[model samples]
Target: MTFHTHHHEQVAEELYDIFESSFDEIFVTDAHGTVIMVNSACEQYYGLSKSDFVGKHVRELEEQGIFYPSASLQVIESKQALEIVQKTDKSRYLHVRARPIFYKNGKLKSVISYSRDLTDLMELSHQVDKMEQQIEFYKRELVQTQSDITGIIVHSDKMKKVFQFIERVSVVDTTILILGETGVGKSRIARLMHDRSSRKTKPYYEVNCAALPETLIEAELFGYEGGAFTGGLKQGKKGLIEKANCGTLFLDEVGELSLSAQSKLLHVLQEKKVRPIGGTKEIKLDIRIVAATNQPLEEMVKKGTFRRDLYYRLNVIPLYIPPLRERREEIIPLVHHFLTVFNERYNRNVEFSPKVFEAFLKGEWPGNIREIENMVERLVVTSERIVTIRDVPFLQQETYTSAHLSLHQKLEELECRLIQEAYEEFGSSYKVAEELGISQSSAIRKIQKYTRGIE
Candidate 1:
């Protein structure tokens, strides 16, 4: 019996040593809520000595305000475990867990509690939340910057759908072909695609195929060797394709490419390499192609004027922009956008009258966004504070006033004007019929009727 008592005392001493060395604050209280034991960590966390709490009732500690609403007392009363966040008088945060200890007779024996400091973790969580908010703010700013850089002003459902498509395709590296009528902002859309893409920081090259002569376009696109032809630069020049390496190349009026040029372009697209004229070496390229045309490439393909294979390669991702007449809802917003732009450019604050808006909304925008921008710039530079109907150009005034006519009369007048213009330009009923996509008999009858009225 004496040896067993000594061994038990040695075991108790070892447990006390372990309890003192624990990193977490640990305390034990009797069933009556009197403090019985506490670890050394409590002194550093709560600024209290073990002697200050040992043998003292929890209520006494609460009255002295050493800690508020004692967790051990609650666990004793409820006979269950409880978790809480407690703050000390020294401005330290603690995550505390208290559990009731039971005896062999199924009766409560004591309460044990554990607490860990939570100050650093809580501070880190707050910092992360602030960083997330800042990231969201910068994302919104980037979106606005992209819109401004791309010159995209959209409101109508038709154009909204187009914008959505642009966003969806910006991440891809596939070739994109933009189909739209002349002056319908196809070039702007191409730029928008480039701006939204991951290659935005790289160089962007634009070439108007129709603007360059057929004899010069091949050399312009494929570049040339030193002294390859008359008037050529000594060092040779880098073609737009080479200039757009690892970036985007916008080919405007791609349908205007001659057959030989189209064949060369197709080879480049297939092999991702460009060979300069009169040069033996071919330079490899990593470029995204964005092509635009006012003409129908599919019809050109059917007529054997455009290579079917090249058309397929360019048409991998086709986006069609509707004309201004189909999206009237966008006119006012576009006008306002241009108004703000020109107002700043010319340093004027001109405004349009209600009647002017009425006239603008009613007229057919044949030249699309380009014409609107030109008109707004004209008004900003020429008109006074408030632009009235009379401030519009004489030719446009006639166009605007004609919108007041009945729908039937408007259609008839437009048809007559078109027929007369086609006859004058082509000078033959067969040519007029072909130009207007109508039968020869219909063209002859319409031309005669409109001409007779003119006489």
Candidate 2:
């Protein structure tokens, strides 16, 4: 009996030495799911000391997402050995194996679990998947013609259909009305239509009807004779429609046109000719009209704000563009695209962290493509080697609030802050315009408005 007791102690000491020396985590729990003992390796694997894990219930730890699937619990239930991969709360991967110990009467006794960290291997596999996706992206890019939407990225099925629509209508000289929410790439789609058309070699002009003041919209669209207005040019200049003769005229925000201006535009679309404001002779035109607007023109037509005849003329080939949030699949590709573009433009090599990508995928993107472009450019220009969620505080909150204000007032305040900072950083309206995706003229106007008292 004395010899047998000494042998059992020696065997227990050897097992304890093995448990302490083992590189992989060794966790033991009783049949009741209570942790009995854990090795020092738990500290490195889970950022917890042996004391933190010992005496704790395995069920509690599993619920806390320490390491999911609770292998010890599974072994206890099955009364057999089990092996499987598990995920920790920190997104780490582990290859775990658990074995059950049985009593002399075949009742459950204890369960021992061994886990090896597989986080590095899992990360490497994810990288390979990303590389494969990149390869597929490059292949799709190669399939597209450079002249077709030069800088646009179309990966979603909805956008692919939009591209197909552009191709079919490009050969025809029909008027197309592009309807979409703001910043949904209506302008770029118009450009793609012009590029794919027979009018590719001719002049292409984009006129932002909303940006042009109501007082000047008519004169700008239909030209003015010399001395037609107080500050007119000495020599009468051809209006955008006349300038775009034999080509395409993209009237952006066409819903903003005044009633009288809409009348004149309808005449031009019907007669294919324009007469200067103070001139007697009329000039013929052979232009393709492509109009885009975020406003509900049909509703405006019912309200008599927009002309009915003009709406019918412009809506001949109506093309609706889905907003970015509706096409979530395209978000990542666009992020990669904008990152590449801004990196090249700014001579910096910056990348978004995985968390940033996740956030982008889950974002609402109220401003659509323009918002993403601006955000990616801002990150590329301002971030270090990697851009994380910390770089975008606006994502955490809907709007900046310093006082009680209406939504419009809040937006104006935000715009004022952005314009001010952009002006300070770039020191030029053109750069600020480019940074904010607005026109240089608009940028100048805003800079004057927002930076009125700044030194």
For model 1, what is the C-alpha lDDT against the true structure?
Answer: 0.78
Query: What's the residue-level lDDT of 414 in candidate 1?
Result: 79
For candidate 2, give the lDDT of residue 119: 60
Residue pairs in clash, model 1: none
Per-candidate TM equals 0.55, 0.57
lDDT of 1 by residue, 1-455 (tens): 99999999999999989999998899899998899999989899888889998999975664354664467877876788976545555655566778998999989999999987655544454455446547646754433331232235565899999999999998899999999988788887887788789998787778899999999998889999999898899999888899899999999999999999999999999999999988999999999999999998999999999999999999999999999889876665566566766777789998664335545665688888887887888999988876755576532424523757998888887787687556533445778889999998898688657643121
* lDDT of candidates 1 onward, in order: 0.78, 0.79
For residues 1-455, write the lDDT of model 2, one tens digit per residue.
Answer: 99999999999999999999898989999988899999888888888778878899875675455765467876876778976555566656566778989999999999999987756643444455457547646644434332222246665899899999889999999999999998898887897788688888788888999898998887888999998888788887789989999999999999999999999999999998999898889999999999999999989999999999999999999999999998886676677666766787699998654446656777899999888888888889888786655577665544478578988998898898798666544446778899999998898789767754221
Q: Which regions of candidate 2 are displaced past 4 Å?
A: 1-150, 397-455
Best by TM-score: 2
